[model samples]
Target: MPLRALFGLLLCAGCAPLSAQDATRAPEPNTRVPAGVVRYAPSVFPDRIVLSPAQDAAHGFAVAWRTDATVAAPVLEIVTAGDSPDMGTPRQVRASSRELRTENGIARHHRADVDGLLADTLYAWRVQGGGTWSAWHHARTAPAPGAPLALLYFGDTQNKNVSLTTRVVREAMRHAPDARLALFAGDLVSGGDGEDDNEWGEWFEANESLPTSMAVAPAPGNHEYFEEFEDTPRERRVLGAHWPLQFALPGNGAPGAERTSYWFDYQDVRVAVIDGTSALDLGTAQAQARWLDGVLAASPHRWNIVVTHQPFYSPRAGRDNALLRKHLLPVIRRHAVDLVLQGHDHVYGRRLPGEAPTPVFVVSVAGAKQYRLSEQAQRTMRPVAEDTQLFQVVRIDGAHLRYEARTATGRLYDAFELRDDGSAKSLVDLPEGRIDERRCERAKTLKGRADRCWE
Candidate 1:
């Protein structure tokens, strides 16, 4: 297929406008129908079954979901089995509901918090919505600081996002099944009906199998915002109801973020997630910034990695990530961050630890969407994928962390290893393959609208 069509195809494919629903009624976009495909609704849609972990990670995890109409209180429960098939059915715990009202309409958000969980242990859980419970999801508590850990990171899958992004993630999982954490550098979804409930469902469904295995650490991207919602940008759009509830994160709230923003110590890793979208565009930047410094300063983990949506520097050459540089750079450099992960440019860019205050900043993209790399990114650039669909598997062992970029079809595009010998150091590079040897690298512009492709 032509590159232009490919670009459009890869960009995010989500809930289209709610086909002129009644202006005076309906809690959500009144769907002529719910679930499955239709000739009229030619595009694929998602179901509202997002299961995440919330609350104190050591003792409790929460589950959340949305329904067309008000649903009865759900029963959140769990069970135990050390990877045994006979782990018996998970038991039920607690359930509650929150009314989510939007211009589109209002719907009930169900939440179930499973309490009395074992520290640093694995268990299975599910929730009962209308008498039927969700499938058993397995998870473990966050490791206290000083524990060894691993996580997966992906860039923006916002525009032209397709099933290819799905395979990239699935392939990454196949590469590292034991990864305890999943890190998204933002741009989870594209900029459009940012308030659409099932839009997030598509994102969650993509990672459902993995959530059953580990907790996810998320950062909001600009696209996560909704300018059409009101005069102001509707960043995050209550994604928390799903984020906090499904991930069952730590309540050690970030210095200023309270529950909406927090930090948690997982093993020897103190993963500090910052909501750049909320802080920068939605009116919480200063507070979150102050808390970020405190979290980094207090982080006693052997490896310190900050995950956010926007990058302090863009390897996209002519591109600039000035806003974040002014806001977050100093803090990161001062604390000596090992790696920075971000997505927005719809391409892959990595920076070395030299001139930059931090060791390395890597930009990655998951999903089928592709972009041409900047010319500046070619020579000065270390590794860049201007127009490729990719994802990364990050494995952390002892004082060492390794990352590999693989194609959605599961080809090892590039691999790098880092050893912490007092400081971050890179070993020999992995063998260069066909991907690394291609000229389809950088182009003047991406396929669709230049603004959409670049953004």
Candidate 2:
């Protein structure tokens, strides 16, 4: 059967293509103060507001935010968004709150699970902390099962988040204004531990209020882990404190890995997030592997995508993640996963299906960090980029999945189309005249002196 026959030919049903003019336009600089320049301390008002998808995104969703301890009990108010000024009677839900101690001070985090929503419905919501209500934000539920879908995927936004990464993130949003979800491959923060409040603040500020409307699914990166000393010479690296306190993820993940390793469905796609850091260093590799095998074995969705912080195929020279690949690659290959989106190498490389075990393996960096590509990657990955920040837009309609990677300023960097006709899959690279491959030899100023190659 033809792929279009198997799945309807709606190709990004609700998404508008980024016009050639818009694609090549210059990126606007962020006006907000960079998180690196100032401290982002929690206050009496609600901040860091974010939304995450539920196990069944069509029926439910999760929202989380941070506030000062004085707020006590916070509440979330929601209603079907309407064009009229009056939103009718609103539904109120009390949030579950938790107290957290950060380097800045003590703050409270609140999460509310909003369920029983109609599929593909648009709703408006707001959070209240200390009698102050945040500006109402709009969110739409996922399309009905088997419907066309669109989403955004980002690589590491670890360094210079507000200053440098925000431009890339905003540019991606411009290209896919109606994207339902924003997926992060991890290393969300540069701080490897201690949960730097300033960095977290910068990350949220960089994203602004975009996450309140779109859901976020982030995998754990090594930068989100650190060693803790407790009367032992060698302390195990543990997940940072900011992770759980900031995002309210679905609790339906691997037992040992919990939030860091989980899976969720959005329309016909099943996104499985793997906790590569904990799996490799925290002795949970086997457990996650088993859990992953089971997850993929039981997935009923038409497309399966795995998101992680560490790449199965390393793009940077001398940065191979052998253990991670050994533990997870087999499971990924066995299940014939459609795509494996990853970060951690701080370079961009996309290996097509035949070249790699999976149909597509992409390693990209969205922040200021850049690294030299390995000889293997240069030879295998056709459109690799370095010294460049990029973002990807992925769209799934019936039997076709279209992927486009664009530069921070909105230029089309690389693109491809994947079609699955129930039994077989085919891939076609889409770019004919892509911008020049960004490598260190053309760089005027070197960044990350020790880790990144200056050439």
Candidate 3:
């Protein structure tokens, strides 16, 4: 029987047709919302405002937001910062808009790229949806070349409890108020596919305290891709519909992997965001590997970091991204990448100064979801944490890079520093009091594992 005919027959018999892809599509048991609940609201005014780094941060930045269909034309108002408190005349730019039909309702997503701004200067901008306009938000352009820089990093926040993630982000912001950029290591939502408007809304709501002025750099995780249909035989998984519409990321990446897998330079650091889902599932790993090497080789920035969903060195025993490690690890080692930030494993683990002078690999979680530390992780990964929500603040000043990881309640968990002395670099682990390690009680079923608590 033909595949289509077989699928039709299965439908008639009330049996679901499974395909090769369907076998691999992991179900997201973490999502707690009921089916058909529309969470995304397209208000008359713009909301979910987000700022992303431009290809050139020194002079450009991108903003994206959502509004109701009633607001046909989307516009942005930008102006140079003035000494006076009063608002000044602004330059208006017409933004391109698109309509997205979610489970709840249709929403108009708008994005604008503003350029020709002064370097190392502060600017204020706002968006308009119909007659309503957003409040003024301020952002600073990238500082002069080789200037000091700081950034906030978060791991997987995919959880039924977004407030936990929200608290972590808020606490991190309080600690690093001057951070120029915020990087999410992926799995930003509990929904594997980005189709859950409510989950997306929860994520945005959690980050309400984060200023729209700061640039956000996000990587895609497995949860961001969902199987289009379960009844069909050809179970194709694709990127979430909201992934691209919500983020106006840099586009300087490989041909097939444009916005999702791209690289950008900010001051003295070069950051690369790679799509691990595409690499592992869509056969784009080779392309990403080649692009990574080219980007690392061409970059002139003193510090190089790569962000992806899966770690090059898997922290969990059974969970392993062997292909990613095989394809990208060599390039990362050869180029001496400074740091690799990753998420997916719902635990915190890092391998600093591995074997030789290799890049520091880190996997962390910022959400309430907790997983058991693998036996391998327990033996190898130093200061591993389970059932703990945490965030990291990294500061780079010339030759020195300092990283601090703190729990959601603002307790220091782990700290480290990497110093580059022109010829060689050294990793110095800073002393910090961390909570006790969490483990799982001997259990047989999924429910038992889920019910496991902190030790």
Query: What local lDDT score does residue 365 receive in model 1, on the 0 to 100 scale?
Result: 84
Q: lDDT per residue, candidate 2, 217-288, as tens digits?
A: 999898888777845987788878888878989997887898688888899899999998888888888888
How do all models score by TM-score? 0.76, 0.88, 0.88
Q: Kindly provide the TM-score of model 2 when superposed on the true structure, using C-alpha atoms.
A: 0.88
Single out the weakest 10-residue window by summed lDDT for candidate 3: 442-451
lDDT of 3 by residue, 1-455 (tens): 44643553443343233344543445444444556655566888889899988878998898999998887778899898887867588998888888888865889899899988888888988999867999889999998667888899999887754546678888988999999999999988857454478788878888884749589999988887787775698777788788888888887877567757988888888999988888877888889999999999988987999999988777765788888988888888999998899998878888746576559889998886776677788777877887688899999999999988888988888888889899889888887575565443322112323223221
lDDT of 1: 0.60
> Highest lDDT, which number?
2
lDDT of each: 0.60, 0.82, 0.80
- What is the per-residue lDDT of model 1 for residues 307-354, given as tens digits with 9 covering 90 to 100? 877666665546675556776777888887777777766777776447
What are the runs in model 1 whose C-alpha is more than 4 Å off?
A: 1-60, 82-91, 101-106, 142-148, 160-162, 191-195, 228-260, 317-319, 355-357, 422-455
Off by over 4 Å in 2: 1-38, 192-195, 230-232, 355-357, 442-455
